[model samples]
Target: MSENHTSTASTPSAPRKKHRNLAQGVVADISEQIQNEILKPGDKLPTESEIMRIQGVSRTVVREAISHMQAAKLVETRHGIGTFVLEPPPAQAFGIDPDTVITMRDVLAILELRISLETEAAYLAASRRNEQQLQELRAALDALLNHTPEDGDAISPDVHFHLLIAQTSGNRYFYDILHQLGTNIIPRSRINAAKMTHDDPAAYLERVNHEHEDIFNAILREDPEAARAAMRTHLSNSRERLRRIQESNEIKSSSDNTRQ
Candidate 1:
């Protein structure tokens, strides 16, 4: 039995590992082509079947490669059409890495930064927002509230809601700063607060929407003091929520270890 097991283990199981490498190789090759201008922006990539035939890879490998490219923002897929190379955006002067944010302290620090910047933005937006801008702000808030956590499309609207406020401030700098921060401004990017609040995901989202409503109403009222106060409260509450999640996770981990 021992000799039989050794013979089976010694036999090469290279096919599965080779397929995984093929997928990664495809991604690297396509990225290099784009860099060399062989695949220009808006140029369509080969179809999945065509790629599979040409690269001698399985359909699964082709799809995995495409997914990697999309995640890197190097390409986009258009329904009824095909995947196309994308023009890279300009380099940001400063930004945070979402992957590096693993702890509640990191999230709280980001919230603190936002409180300092966005509180003033809300105040300025209250004074400077025009009628059309005010309407847009209301629309953004409505969009946010319209989606539940289950849909997984709630983050975009939430980001837009804050972005509209920055734009309304009449300071292009404020909007640029927030845009540079990208989706990291959304708390969900750093911490999956919705999933962590396992009691009721919909209720969690609704509670957040209520906070947004307060900020929106204050801005609509054109009360700078109220707007500033509301914005500050929203961010402070977010910090507390993340802290609670961190503590809960630690407790659960300890319990599991003790049981083990």
Candidate 2:
């Protein structure tokens, strides 16, 4: 025991650095490839294992990157088939990052933008929509009504419903703008306002569907004025609902702090 000695290395140990966020890095690389046209629309993405091996990332990181790309509308997954790149929207299309929208004010501002664009769109669609377009609109509405928000993300059908209206407007610009906004335009995408409206998500979604029906009916009847009014009312109601959610959240936060 008295002769015991410890050995130490002459060189100092190097500090370990944290790894980069592999998912975000993959998203950036893939998005860059798409932007550079290296991965053209309709081109199939590499298999997950291939991507993992090439990028030196885990399967989880690859999946996360794919999810982000889907949310951005850059790619779509086909069941039993590999994921494929989507055709890029026109250069004029407008895009808003979902992360930038963090408050009711932000949501209301976007709704304001929508009201300006869509009230006119509803009027134009009511007057110009053809039989096929009208049928498509109804189908989109039906999809929304049938979808269960509790079961999965309900934003796609809701966004599609509005996109169909924009397309019906016969103005390609309107459709491009909404398409550029993508699924982020759906209120549920940014906030859980549905729960604030009703404890049961189904009831809240049903109410939203009824509002949609009002707009659809107005468009179906070819009443431009009614369509405009209904669209305005629908958007205004959305803003009000989100405002209520903001207030409720504020109250809950206050109560939580008081308890603390």
**lDDT (CA) per prediction:** 0.84, 0.84
- Residue 207 displacement (Å), model 1: 1.4
- Enumerate residue pairs that collide in model 2: none
What TM-score number comes out for model 2? 0.59
Clashing pairs in 1: none
Query: What are the per-residue Cα lDDT tens digits for candidate 2 across 69-102?
Result: 9999999999889899999877753578778877
Residue range with the least summed lDDT across 10 consecutive positions in model 1? 182-191
lDDT of 2: 0.84
TM-scores for the candidates? 0.59, 0.59
Off by over 4 Å in 2: 1-93, 185-191, 258-260
Write model 1 residue lDDT over 208-235, tens digit each, in one string: 8889999999988899999999999987
- What is the overall TM-score of model 1 with all chains considered together? 0.59
Instruction: Please identify model 1 stretches exceeding 4 Å from their true place.
Output: 1-92, 185-191, 256-260
Predicted structure 2: clash tally: 0
